[model samples]
Target: MTTHVQLHDRLDYQSVAPLMAELTAIADDMLVIDAGNVRHLGTLPLQVLLSAVRTRAAQGKITRLAHASDNCIDMLGLFGFTPETLTQPEAWT
Candidate 1:
């Protein structure tokens, strides 16, 4: 089963640590991130996200971003992540 992480609006440095901890604790085969409410993206949070996504892929697990907000998508794009690419883990390599 997939573990769902509900993202918030402020994913800044103040929140990244806890968020990263939550993400790292998931033991499911798939991780589903609900980014619909993400309005701000900070460098730390973005790094944490990229690490989680890449780590999951390296382990042959899935990391999915479902219903991401426009702001979230734009911020992720800066790091080379498109909605299509998010689904294709190999593209992240």
Candidate 2:
């Protein structure tokens, strides 16, 4: 089952351990992590996202992020995450 992750709070530079865990559960399915309303972005969030995506990808399943903010894009680049709109693009802002 594909799950849509809509984010509205601080995603960057914040500990997403709790969020990560929740996302992990749907790792086996198509996941959409929405960050359209996010304002702050940081490396930690990027790390968590990458890690989660990688983990899910390895299982033949993948995670996707959408509606990312500019800050999200910067963080993705800063963390070396390539251009994947749903994964690291600021479509929302």
Highest-scoring model, lDDT: 1
lDDT of 2 by residue, 29-57 (tens): 68877877666666666667666766677
For model 1, the superposed segments whose C-alpha errors exceed 4 Å read 86-89
TM-score of every model versus the real structure: 0.87, 0.72
lDDT of 2 at 68: 73
TM-score (C-alpha, index-matched) for candidate 2: 0.72
Evaluate model 1: give its lDDT: 0.85
Task: Highest TM-score: give the candidate number.
Answer: 1
- Predicted structure 2: lDDT: 0.65
